[model samples]
Target: MERTRNSWKCPIFGDLNDLKDNVLPTYGDVMRFYEWTRHRLKYERERNKEPTYKEIEAIVVARLIEIWAKSSIPTVEPKRMKVMLQTYHLKCKNLLKSNPRIPKNTLEGFRLGSKALFDIAACKCQEFLKCACPKNKKIPARERGFITDQRTARQMVIGALDVVTTTKITKTLKRKSIRENSKSKRLKKPKHVRKS
Candidate 1:
């Protein structure tokens, strides 16, 4: 009997090599190809009228499913997935516009393809138990203070030191004057006050 291609040398009985080699293309390769095609489409679209948003969305979702099927990454966040799919769809729409031979019927096909892909991505994401990220999450607000700059911080410290020194000198001077005034009052008092 003819020996089938030794799909693997490992003692394992499973046939994953065949699946990798024959059944589906690698995810990276497919995504790269898609990106190149998208670039071409973009260049073409710029010279022509752009596709509608709905049409663009459909194209992207469909392309995303194709990418997801082969990707090693099992789960994709819903928003990121949508963004990825949208980018591809817009690119495809641009490509289709440039091609003169593809019929109106093909546009309908693209729409259907997009919807099917969107549904598939949604189902897969749900199965994988991914999180729904908050829309409001953002970069933290900047701190408000005089300490933002090292130079400013140093200047502020110097200013504080000057205020402290001025306050101490004023207090010392005030105490000395009060003591001198009290001594003068005692010296001016009559000799009858000496008994006290």
Candidate 2:
């Protein structure tokens, strides 16, 4: 009799090793994780106050590690996870910086930032899960008719984020458009004929 070797291991759950080959994480798991994190952060804020960036970063990193470990991929390394988290953090920060109308101290700004982070995480998780599985193999959930495609998953994340931050995004876009339109109008006006 030949023994089969399992290549995948859950970093957070040692007991999951036995089932790693048989099971894989689903898109639903990613969504649920985001929802859970958002609610937990909200509750914590209500009880105490706004958590510091370090506190939020710690929570985000821990949750990501747990989620990735639960997936079919083998061994979510700390370095890779931290790099991913840092990239998303920078993206969210840049988004805020670009949208000057959205005051960072306001409740709306905080909510938008949280939503953006969740969106980034969800998109990354979907891409990672889709590509992690071998081409010849069907995802565990896909075989059961869960029917999650990469494009659809990405679009869903983007749409959800858009819905949440539409006002802020649109306002900034409108301002930019108006500025551009005025600049174009000025350029269109022929320079007054300079007669010596």
Candidate 3:
């Protein structure tokens, strides 16, 4: 009798319910929700191309820079923020590779867009700082929270944008070169076939 109840409780009415009602709700749910949102945004970008992955990545980096720039020291600490942004950028590249509508050249365009956006932001910041540190001035507090100095925050935002843009351009160019090499090899193969 006890064994029957224990068996039923072991999974159906027992520990599983407690976990489902409690632990799972606290941890896995939130993490999965975030992942789902990320994937959703990725797919939306893939479909519309309005917000390219590079743009998204640059925006995030810009936010990071803005947060750090506001600090008295004006540096991105904790290091992990940089790592996560790079990881997300890589994921975007992989997603773009699988997307048929995202042209090879568009990848390059995104790279350029990121750099241009960063440059614009940085230039604006610098202009504001002609008296001193303008880079720290333009950071919108809504993006980076209320913790750091505005000028430092703005600089950090540009730095983060630069990092993502540079990494993406390098990766895309490497892929483009490989494709070109493959094309050249195919041309050479046709010549050899004619000789044979």
Candidate 4:
């Protein structure tokens, strides 16, 4: 995520490897541009033109971003999670051990990232925040439950329109550079170092 290939604009992430350690995107984006781009890029790369890239390159890119988003979690509501863990401690009377799926010690770091993301998502789903997600202002309390659910579903859909997209420039570029340096280097170890 850069404004341009290489510009004065600061990049969203400092390093490519940091992507996995960062947030995860949700699943089932109906309008992911990558799905289309995957094929198109493959076609172009075969011709040796850089309009796109495909095949193994495309697979790697997908692995780099969506894999984490789809496979694992990126921290969830943490300030909330802390409040939850603390409440757990109080309720269970186990201050030292509360069986948190995520421990409280890492809460500081989790708070920093999740606060921003949670606020963004929460703000959108709020009673009214002026986001792309529709606002159901002044609905009856009795109907608010379903209305809220509907709004949330709409929010996810609207947010996902052409949303699942990213360029793994850093990784591929680094790989190409490494290839230039040493041809036989495998990025990862084989399934078995020794076969039976």
Q: Tens digits of per-residue lDDT for model 1 on 52-166?
A: 5555444544555554344222334546756765565455647455656757676556544432222222222221224343322211122112122211222221121346755
- List candidate 4 stretches off by more than 4 Å: 1-32, 44-125, 129-196
User: Each candidate's TM vs. the true structure?
Assistant: 0.21, 0.32, 0.21, 0.18
Q: Give the winner by TM-score.
A: 2
Ranking by TM-score: 2, 3, 1, 4
Leading candidate by lDDT: 2
Candidate 2 local lDDT, 1-196, one digit each (tens): 0112222221111111111112233323333333344445656566645446556556655665554334322333555555655665565456446665655456354443333222222223344345554443334442222123322332221111235455775898899999999999999999888899
Off by over 4 Å in 2: 1-49, 100-196
Candidate 1 Cα outliers beyond 4 Å, as residue runs: 1-75, 117-196
lDDT for every model? 0.40, 0.41, 0.39, 0.33
Model 2: residue 58 alpha-carbon error in angstroms: 2.3
lDDT of 1: 0.40
Better of 1 and 4 by TM-score: 1
